[model samples]
Target: MKTKIIYLLMACILLVSCQNLNRPSGKMTRVERVVSGQTIEIADRSAAVPVLEPIRLIGIQAPDIRQKPWGEEARIELEKLTLGQEVLLEFDVQEKDRFNRLLAYVWFGGKLINEYMVKEGFALAEPDFPNTKYMERLINAQERARLMGLGIWNPDQPMRQTPAQFRRQIGNRE
Candidate 1:
């Protein structure tokens, strides 16, 4: 069983690394971990070696696990969509964040995972950043999700806090 999983992983790694690192579009990376709704750990291994890179999805912010149900839901949704998949990573003006995680728009199965996250109401559109590559799409999705009251936007539930707001509160408290 373990061997099969390992082989599958290796195959995915191989599939993603077939392109040049300097390609204009982006790196083809295999999703290794869904760290959160907005973050993931991807790998690009060439020559049968392993190289893991943490990635932060651009244009959206999902609830943190500290936010309870919303966070957990978002994480699960991301895992369902991207775990073990070979996703294409497209960059904008900013390549990486302060934490050194690659900032990108992730595509899986020809669909934009970042936009899907917002469309499902699992995340909020983040327009503060300059990328704006998929800004309109993200914003529209979030609006639709909000109108539908799906996931975190459900009216019956307690008011949910944005991950950024939570981070700020945590910083101030500490």
Candidate 2:
């Protein structure tokens, strides 16, 4: 009786561990829309009912709305690449942001979207908090973009100058 009980307990533990391992470490889903240069909405198939979830790509930083002249173009490029396609999201360590948005490394048909954005000069490697999975890739991409003079790399682009520079140039005219 004692041997049987021990065997049953061990078997149960092994079964549970195996099941957990079998669960998808990463999931592939269709993107509903591109939210910005670094984020997108994906249709989640894991729930009992299907749902569209916003996934913030980890380890990359695209130009923000308040950034220099090429910010909008960066966003546009991202939209063009992933607006309506199926992508595979691979989770590394952290899963969600403070807003409960899923944080992931997005892959579209074997292409890594985050890395592509950086490589194309649309974004920079943003190593802020739980999103450091692809830091090396992002850095390399940024370097390449800078070398090729793409997007924000153009020196003649107009943008909102810093407050100090504005003050100096305007000389209290406002």
Candidate 3:
């Protein structure tokens, strides 16, 4: 069992390293819409027909839409930053999620939007494996946001529940 696990781990590492070698140069695309705080739709013109591809911002998770004002605030903030704007998409190890949403670190005006959202306290640093190239940067941004008590970190009206928690609760109810 131990040997099997070791081989599996090695294989995973090898696969990830191979994927990293061919990292996509920033693909410039126009934001079609904001699905939520952490997701956006972009017009992908790579194919014969343009397709609206949903992108899930890597390294951070924002409040769920069911999380009341915090969720809406996050959506609004994301919209303010990205809606109708041309943004650059940088991919890491995994290019897409199980939902087929493109997983990327978004950049606008030379700023990493994923880190910006965490720094602004609009989202929490949620590291997902094999796609954590910017995890430390995001965690540091979250710390700064926490110290400054911005957005969801505000002492008086802070977001009490995490986006994951909110999602689980909603899922249970359904």
Model 3, range 60-103, lDDT digits (tens) per residue? 99999878888888999999999999998998999889998999
lDDT winner between candidates 1 and 3: 3
Best-to-worst order by lDDT is 3, 1, 2
**Pairs of residues at least 3 apart in sequence or in different chains that clash in candidate 3:** none
Between candidates 1 and 2, the lDDT winner:
1
Scored by lDDT, the top model is 3
Candidate 1 — which pairs collide?
none
Question: Highest TM-score, which number?
Answer: 3
Q: Write the per-residue lDDT of candidate 1 for residues 1-174, one digit (tens) a residue.
A: 999999999998877886554334677878999989899997756648877878999989889877888888899999999999988999998888889998999988779999999998899999847788889989999899989998888999944567878889888999
TM-score of 1: 0.79
Q: Rate the local accuracy (lDDT) of all candidates.
A: 0.86, 0.74, 0.92
- Evaluated at residue 86, the lDDT of candidate 1 is 87
Model 3 stretches astray by more than 4 angstroms? 1-24
